[model samples]
Target chain A: MYDDRKYTEENMPKTGILLEVENTELKDINFGLVTAARDTGANEVLAFTTEELGTEAQNDLARYGVSQLIRLRTDSADITSSPDNCAAACVQAAREYGLEYCLGLATAFGRDIFARMAALLDVELAADVLQIDFKAKTAVKSHFSGKTMATVSLQETPGLLTVRPNAISPVEQPATLESSVFQADIQSQAKVAVKEIKTSDDRKMDLTEAPIIITGGRPIGKPENYAMLQECADVLGGAVGASRAAVDAGYAPHSMQVGQTGKTVSPNLYLACGVSGAVQHFAGMKTSKVIVGINKDKDAPIFEKCDYGIVGDMFEVVPALTKALQQEKQG
Target chain B: MQIYVCLKHVPDTAANITLKGQADYEAGAVKFVANPYDEYAVEEAVQLVEKDGSGEVVLVTLGPSEAVTTLRSSLAMGATRGLLVKTDEKFCDSKTTARALHAAILQDGSPDLIFTGKVAVDTEGSQTPYRLARLFDLPVANEVSALAINDGSAVAERELGAGNREVLEMKTPCVIGTTKGLNEPRYPKFPDIMKAKKKEIKELALADLDPALDPRPNLGKLEPVPERSGATMMEGSVEESVAQLIRTLKEGKML
Candidate 1:
């Protein structure tokens, strides 16, 4: 057990954040993870990355209180191709640094690597946590799809946790940065290899990572109607989403759907256009910082749950909103 | 060929979950259903076996006896039989759960393929299938949106973030975690539901598998998510509402 009084300013717990990269750039969500690590206050934050950490990336991470950046290297195999190798490399780094806590985002890659880490280390993993208290070795996580929250206590050493993206507000805490590299000894061959990665023609950001999203509902009569929402999304530097009803009606694909059965998104702003706001859809995005519902039906369930409600026909409201945003940008 | 589909009985996504105490819930009235993602796995398993014309789909779950309902539902959807690893423990960490599942699978005999939901909705522990893969030394794919099986091998496609898809091929006796967009799960017909009542549901105690593990992460407190209040209704013409929204976004510095 850790003594709370022993954590002085000079001797604090060390937190290792598993950084994620997308398209050769550091993922924006890692900033929030760094901030959450710092908020624990008992830890000196360091970042570990498997991806190449250029000078610019190190500088970016330093601004978020990362005092050191350790890049894991493999001599034999590409770590990115195999999650087992990646987890092995991470475990090596954690052991080398004597890290007391390991943190990561609860995304596809994080889920893959951390599970392996938990198995290898024989430690408990608190997956997709919403809040954490390092001193108490406890975390709060949502259960039953956000309907309830449970506080969990870690019974082992070197706590392992993966937090939901955008759950913590990012705060800038600049620190002097240092960098190092460690090569891990990985012996296991990759059982499953990523043979090919096919990118879709849609170049817009994904709804899960978008800072803002505009979602259409069943009232979107046809597929082309999504163009309007796309235009508005473009103005806001956001992405276009759809309710399950709209996807079922062929107005959009399942990838664009945002509901319980679809992607769960936590954006700064979510504009629901013409959605009746079923509980299933709300469960996916209830954690969004702000929800704005626009619907013709005044009694729609979405109105009661959203931070702002506009009772109006979406056909008229969305176009006007887009025009206003465009003019605002130009002016 | 033999196929196994792992199922978990979770609180219905629509259930109004209420906390009963610091580490418990008022689950007496809550209804449990086959996790929606696991339903996709069940459907895919049935389709694969039916296509082969010489295989059976087995449904397995680790939960209390009431979880038999979940297995029966899968049986109704065309599974050949069911297995329930009965346990009275209220909570088990993902690793322990995986150990139990691994023991159960070994006891029942290894299959050519295994299917599970990518993540359970209640715990959202997306670790079971991968842990099982490691335990059995089998290749595994997760969040698989498409799958094709041939003689002794299988091809799977997993959806990556940012609208990308990764195609992978692995040998047989592999594990696959099914996600949405895999297939439309069939609704069980009345006749099938009636037949499911008579389907064999083998029960085993925790001691039967005798998994050597301990629950690590333990639950501490349970609480309802704090509700968001103070919604401002925008009551105005179309142009006015749009203007107000723009102004509000600017004030929030979100524009």
Candidate 2:
């Protein structure tokens, strides 16, 4: 059902990826974005960044088939602090490079910039898209919190797409990397200026980016019981999450809640402890490579959805699993 | 000062959303509620107006006549009045919707501020506020978790994911798309609900607004997500299960 024809270099579409940077380092999510762009059968994949690309960033992006790295710079305004200015610069770059498609990860920053770019270019934007077919100028996105999926086609040129993070897996296709700097001469008309950025003091990995995640449900009687899951999470280098029921019960904050109304996570391994396997919670983590459910009820819905199931009290199963992993590490 | 807050009626978050056909949903069993994120915007607008002790919070929506129910709910929560841009179109893209809203706002006299949810729960398109901002040539701050308004300027904080936030300052006459954690929305009292029924709801048609606007980004096909099946149920003690899981993960080089 998918198009398998390969495009020759002469007629290939040029795809530009808006690279994200955090703490002067490139985010690993960009590699996946680069791969997604290349998967569109683009002849040339370009990485656009407001930050200075070091050797490591260049090496990493090149491994994902990014052929060109363009540093978008402007003396008129601080692109990092002004989203309008940043988007203006990106639009200028896209125009100058004759880009047919511009892709970005659908994080807060990407959503902000791409919205502005779409407006400035007077083009249509597909936000939080799951799949894109560049040749057809079409994309598929989830509607109603993922209950329904819609395929939308952009008739306008320079199709702008913001892909949900982790929606696409990264693939390695080494390319010869060439770098250049583009200084956009656009004037900034931004009324909003970012004055400060505050990072949370808690150093735990973000649930969305964690390799492994252990989530608790309503069965977690009290907030203190989360400590047991935290122990297992620490040993596995994962993050601790809670179901919507747990959050509604005031056992955890919304930031740590995983469900249709909360954060959507795609991890390598998801351990659902005492969860009833409500569709709401399952929708958020169904993309996990492996789902393991621990519940005392043999008929719990989670068991049917999980790769591995254990019919036991979470109070008994969680601690035993933590201890076993700890001993295994020590041995 | 005047504030315009855009609202959308969406299916309840817990409701089971079923597809009726390729491009529509079965609304028979689903209950519609005010978009949760938009409630934050309405609450923020009400708080800002109440803080100033003078001003009006006008609710606006672009949908069918049934959307008036959503506007009434917002009015019950303390909005001054509402404007419903009634459209017969089954679906309107963000850009077209923004243009219609822009025309309506201009017809009502440009307000000092505009508020909308960061994204609609139904469509999940987080573009209306930004598109409106651009069409009106106004500055905007989206996904604002915290907000403060002063004489002619405002300061807002946007969550940047991963527990980071950026503090931003923008002038009035700008658009702000509110996110969660901005403020708790208050439930309307019985008396207010009764009064909201009588409040004025001015309905306008798309043709009544700027006729130049046309919907773009046409929808092609819609299909239900395929079901995921085939999960193996482990049969063993807790220790045995953990051991087997670990061994399998190790063999696959996933751990």
Give stretches of model 2 more than 4 Å off.
Answer: A1-7, A222-224, A326-331, B248-254
Q: Give the TM-score of candidate 2.
A: 0.93
- TM-score of every candidate's chain A: 0.94, 0.89
Residue pairs of candidate 1 with colliding backbone atoms: B22-B221, B22-B222
Docking outcome class, model 2: medium
On the 0 to 100 scale, the lDDT of residue A231 in model 2 is: 93
DockQ comparisons of all candidates to the true complex:
0.71, 0.65
lDDT of 1 at A306: 87
Deviation (Å) of A96 in candidate 1: 1.6
lDDT tens readout by residue for model 2, B1-255: 699998887788778877776677777578888888999999999988898899999998888888898889889999999999888665688888888888898899768999999988777888898889998888899988899888788899987765778999988888999977798899999999999999999999887786776655377876776655735665577788778878877877668
User: Which stretches of candidate 1 lie above 4 Å from their native place?
Assistant: A1-10, B211-217
Worst 10 residues of 1 chain A by lDDT: A3-12
